[model samples]
Target: MAKNSEKAVKKTTNKIVKSADNSGTKCLEDKNYKIENPLDEEYVNEVHVSDFMKALAYDPVKGVDTSNAEHISAWTDALPVRGTTSSTKNQKKPSKRKLREQEAAKPKGISHSLLQYPLIFMIGLIMFIELIAYISLRQIVRIWENVFSWRGKKRTLRNNLRASKTYKEWCESADALDNYMHKDEWKKTIPFAYYDYRLLQKVVKHLKMYRQGDTMEDATKLMDVLYVCLKQNFAGIENAKLYSNTYLGTKALIEEYVEEVTRSIEALASNKYISIEEKRLAFKLYSKNYGRTAFCLSGGAGFGYYHLGVIRALLDRGLLPSIITGTSAGSLMGAIVCSRTDEELDLILNPELSSRIRICQDNWPTKLYRLVTQGSLFDAEQWCREAMWFCKGSLTFKEAYERTGRIFNVSVIPYDPHSPPKLLNYITAPDCVVWSAVLASAAIPGILNPVVLMQKKRNSEHLIPYNYGHKFKDGSLSTDIPTLALNTQFNVNYTIVSQVNPHVHVFFYANQGSPGRPVTHLEGRGWRGGFLASTIEQMLKLDLAKWLKVLRSLKLLPTVNDQDWSSVWLQKFDGNVTILPKSDLSDWLHTIADPDADRLKKLMGSGQIRTWPKISMISNRMRIESCIEKVRRLLRTSPKSNRVGRFNSYSDAEIEKLSQHLEQHDTTNNYANNSDAGSGDELVFLSRRRVSMPDGSFQHLQDKDSIKEQNRRRKFMAQFLDSPKEGNNSTQSSVLFDSHSDDSDSHSPPPSSPEDYTHN
Candidate 1:
């Protein structure tokens, strides 16, 4: 009876039942893995809900941890009988075509070593050798060709020299430089270096050979140095000359020079981060870190020397800034980083890629020219246009900001040159964008010239109205610009709340200039629409010059090229001409070129005794170097204050409260976070931690450090700030490298970050 009952129970358990596969799982039939229908017509509509139904028994709202639950209760407890489990799962024979494919797919019964492809490898080696031999033969032929083409090489070199824009002899403009430097009586007030005639002579020689003649001579020099002019008639000339091309063939030559210079600059093409292979960036933001406090970077002018080091440190440690304020040179670094793909960024940030970034200030000759022609300089807007023309295969400025909101650039503008200067937030600048704005900001007094924005006049293809007062400069000149504008526009103070960082607010200026400095006006703007604009308009009143487009619409003042009036004004005028009518344009330019006319300076009634500032290449370079040295000194040296790290005693709440209570501290960024500025020691400590230095002081070794430098800076800073009262000298050397050392990492590390920057 017991055996019969067990048999009945087994039979009931194996009874056929149909069920819906809610989980999409297929039921296993038997161990042999034969496919068979589990349902029969008698139980076709049956459905199982046990697995899902059991889920309701667990508590999900209270944060239950049942992830490890494993029970057989969810599975159907039925097993097939031995006599009916597909009867040994008999194999089904495949069709003839399938059998043939299977046979063909089988490997040959041979030794594994025979499949080594040694014969193919040998053939490839022979081919490579043959290629090498062929290359050698080609090189031998080239050598012979070179020997025979000696004359051709000379001719090519001569042609290249003549084609260069810097190829100049000497000009009337050079005389001013000579007098300013060589004049002894007036030299006492000016520095000795400005009187260095050799530099003046050398620059003029290169200036005269452009074959463009003296008409565009001033323009060429200005472009070479990236100069700008804020005020017109700075020399107080009641009568000013406009577009000095009064010669017959001179107009044509000037046009040729323009085209030549444009073509030449544009021809300096380079790899825009080769797109031959697609690549991924090394640093990718984690999903969890989204919306976290971002870093802020503000750019200063020509500060790339320092910004370069800071960027590398940030990348090494995976810290991305939430926002950025990129000014002059700061803008350049920002654009470079933002525009590059992560993969391209890795290669671009390297010191080796220095050749690719062209900063006009990098050269000595140009740097000198910039200082000499500070306010008298004119901009070469053509340079910006050409730069973009060559950026063929790289991510453009606009594209970099298409997603991720990594940067929020500030553009200083009046929106029209006729208007007053105003700071703009959210980078959709009226006329200029990223790179263009960068050049504008670096349009420092002695550096690059300001870019002119032209608004097409109504129904006049021949005329364009220029409100040049609408200009932009480096963003760092006013790192607080965006914040100020942001506050006013949104009607909320950033000190209490931030649009970016919620936990902490940080605003950093990567370049020079102070946040407290007010926005300055360009003197030329008022003059543009005043008597000068009227006079130029009267000159362009004639239709002939407009029809011929005579040398940058000479007929029209303030056209794109004529934004800054007054051609390279020479402090040292070539006063060699004894008697030519100022009205006679052709005779005057030619008369001064004669060697005998040089004596006219003596013949003239008397040499003016005007005092000129001593400015020269060496002095200008020294000025720049001194500024860099000062920055390094400040960063490398320990805090000068009697209270080194007073904030160590404050709690996070105390710090936050102190940061919030003070009207000086912005919720996110506080550029003037000095402890002395306010009673808050928290901001002072924060500011100290962010001081900019050189690469060597980074505390964390990026590469090749046998002794680990990681956390050394932080620890050192903590010790300095919170340690028992001690002089900075004792521990300064331990935390920083020698600033004057000749090594690559001789200086200390700059402020850390890979943050977002807004540029103006």
Candidate 2:
């Protein structure tokens, strides 16, 4: 019986061992094995079991008791550092629902996303404050200006239009422009100016290197043709001369019968006489619009007024200056007022407007705002933008370039310390012109920060075909007339690149050498008393000849060849440009008083020029020396350099004979005679009539008699300029000629002039 019982016990022990071994293998295979405890019902299936734990966790259901000392010790070791006390093992595990309820019973808190509301609200409030401040200030300024706006000297418009031109005048303009148009060299010259000749040649060579070099000639011609087509279709050249100028008051004196004058002007436009475009040209000239006028603003704050005054004078006199350029503040103002109406100018000059837009801050609001965004007290870009806004009266410069035909230019410096500045214009694209120039201009080393701008370039094959760039600043430190610094053959193809020159006009503030003094025409006929004037004269006298000699020495024009390479210091110096007011200029203006000196002066001053308009009534009188300098610069510097001479460079007799021959050839066209109604005799008639009548002013024209006299003037002018051509000539000169009477219209014939027959 004992042996059988012992056998049973051994069998039981073997069975239990087999079960423990099986559980260990299962634990290894299944990482998520669980241990069950009857006391811990809530923890059912939740307790993790390791391979080692399999040895210790014997199942109660199996009834394989851990009564052996070894088994008991292994189980105790696996129970954790502090063996499970009675209270610990008896504790039940909580269910998911019960835990969730316990979590709900704890405290709740705010979320991160929700916490952002107050911050957002604060930002919005700050922006609202800034907007309100900017707007309110602008309104205040507008009202202040309307009350104290400047009023320049009002002079009666001078009546200078002549009814007819002598033959010499007609020959000059027509011969040069018309004859030159047909020549292959001149034809290419125009296009050469539109594109860089060297670059164009390189392209041609590249396209044909594998083939005959000459083989690409046809392709080049085709490209030229395409460029011409593009220019006509997209460029703003044809309409460039158009501008809004107050009409000349003198027109009222001669426009007696409105319909009659209207008919005459219309007749001038007829194909039978001058073409419509020519008629417009003539009208513009009569209105005092220079053929190609440019208004350049300098970098001065208060100085803008002087520029505006000059512009206003130009407008009042109906002067048309098609090209507009500016630098620094000048650039800002030019972009702001380029296409503005007369009334709109009032809004531009408002003080509050200046306060808002000033790049350098005196006020706290703009400064504070700038500090916040730029992470400092000043930001160059923001300042430039504000300055533009102050001048532009708008956020973007698109509205600033509203004049359809006018050329707009702004000066900017490359952000790179080594790169030279350039003139930027909107003809390329509006965005390219404004921001690039404005920001670069304000990259004042110590003052404003530099800015980046978008640059667009075309890739022939790609639809978008463009890229952008930024990294430039205000260009005032370098070239003053950035446009003038360009090559003589600089691009003029309006469809592709802007051909406009950027002339600078400085307007200094009170603290900045000018006291923000409102201009009211200079007094004392513009004095020459100050030490400044005398010093200038002495400087001119001392150094004028040196200037003339240097100017005369150039083999080519300063435009074609600059003397900069001759200076060793300039070659070695690596520094930002320094612009100073001209002093000791005598070296450049020697022999200015001499008649022959003009020739030399013109050469030296031809490429680049600086001038102060005597108008606008500024308190500062441009000394008479300034006027002398102006004239000196206008002269021909080098006597040896003779590229071309005037049209009627010949004697009076020869020019007169040429004119008569042209008239005879146009017999089929019924050309008017010199004694016709529009002839110089009209002036004789007017002078004789003036003795018997009141002055032919606008006031006098209200009466019927004055009206009749005015009618006569218009009728005669129309007959002079709009009459059918009765002459033609085989000579190239035949293309343009004027008829003149041997018999004087007055005591002496009006001085024979090339201007008499001004080309339309």
Specify the highest-lDDT model's number.
2
What would the per-residue lDDT of candidate 2 be over residues 106-170, giving only the tens digit for each residue? 33445523534454455446545644553454345435434443222121111111110211222
What are the per-residue Cα lDDT tens digits for candidate 1 across 1-760?
Answer: 2232334222321220111111110111112332222111011111111111122222221222233322222111142111101111232344586457554644454552364355335544654564455345435533643454324534354334323221021111222222322221222121122122232222223333432333333333322211111011111110011011110011111222222323222211111221101000000011001111222233332223334434443342233342444444445555555644444444444333333333342345554664455431323432353233222212223344442234435434322223333443233332223444455555544445444322222353211112221334433322312333433332111110111110001111101111111011121112222344334333432221122222222222222321222111100111101001111223233221211212222111011100001011112212222222222222222233222122223342343333333321231232222112222222222222221135412232234331233133223223112112211111111101111222111112111111111010
RMSD value for candidate 2: 41.7
Task: Score residue 181 of candidate 2 by CA lDDT.
Answer: 27
lDDT of each: 0.26, 0.29
Model 1, residue 660: C-alpha shift (Å):
35
Error of 1 at 702 (Å): 60
Error of 2 at 334 (Å): 1.2
- Model 2 / residue 503 / CA error / Å: 17
Q: Which stretches of candidate 2 lie over 4 Å from their true place?
A: 1-267, 270-290, 301-320, 351-355, 362-377, 391-399, 402-406, 433-436, 455-470, 483-536, 540-760
Q: CA shift at 667, candidate 1, in angstroms?
A: 20
Per-candidate TM-scores read 0.25, 0.31
lDDT of 2 at 513: 13
In candidate 2 the C-alpha lDDT for residue 288 amounts to 19
